[model samples]
Target: MSTARWVLHLPAAATSAEGVDRLAQALRDSLRHVPALDFGELTISAEDDQSTRRRVWCDAPLGGDRRCALRTNHPDRCLDR
Candidate 1:
């Protein structure tokens, strides 16, 4: 199966390294059900928004569009590990 490129916008409040770790872990825990694709090429950045200069950015590999929503919108489903 082919993989999809995904960029999940981390919470704006997440400015510290520890915050990034939590969000990354949350993302991993959320996608545990998908066993076909492996997540890699991960990156975290701070974009200079017009309003807010410092913003959290965390992105990784996703199986496809089907799994994107679960990680992006539904945090409740993600394991809080």
Candidate 2:
């Protein structure tokens, strides 16, 4: 791994189907547990990409797109982790 920062290997389609507004809410909800210092630019995909799922990274998102719902929307994954 290139020592750049985090490595959040999300499923890519963490929160799909849900509207963008709901997704953004979800992302915010997830970030509550994380510290702001670990924050980094947020990124998302219209759908799950095989390549991205393999290389997970976690950079705190200040905020994200209001267009697509988060790709990786797992309820258990959020609160549990």
Candidate 3:
């Protein structure tokens, strides 16, 4: 089987990177039921500079094909959901 990637550009009223990250997390949480959505791979970028992206999740490999469920750059130890 083949998998395809999809990108959705959402415009938000957040004024800072942290605010945007929160918005992204809320969106992922609301859509958690969708199996096709890879919450761990979530990212955000400025409207003008899509080339530079900021990750929303830690997404570190946690063995057995599991990934960290913490936010990006989290100070605590990685956890899997």
Ranking by lDDT: 3, 1, 2
Writing each residue's lDDT as its tens digit, candidate 1 over 5-80 gives 7764444447775786577667656875776434333345554443433222222234444323223334454322
Candidate 1 clash figure, as a count: 0
**For model 3, what is the C-alpha lDDT against the true structure?**
0.83
Weakest ten-residue segment in model 1 by summed lDDT:
52-61
Model 2 C-alpha lDDT per residue in residues 12-75, reported as the tens digit of each score: 3445534543554566667747764222244444564534522112332334422222234433
Per-model tally of clashing residue pairs: 0, 16, 0
Give Cα-based local distance difference scores for all models. 0.46, 0.41, 0.83
lDDT of 3 by residue, 1-81 (tens): 888878765567577887887888888879989887788877788768879987889999999978998988999999986
Name the weakest run of 10 consecutive residues (lDDT summed) in model 3: 6-15
Cα displacement (angstroms), candidate 2, residue 39, comes to: 5.9
Off by over 4 Å in 3: 1-13
Clashes of 2: 16
Residue pairs with backbone overlap in model 1: none
At residue 72, give the lDDT of candidate 3.
Answer: 85
Give the CA lDDT, 0 to 100, for residue 39 in model 2: 23
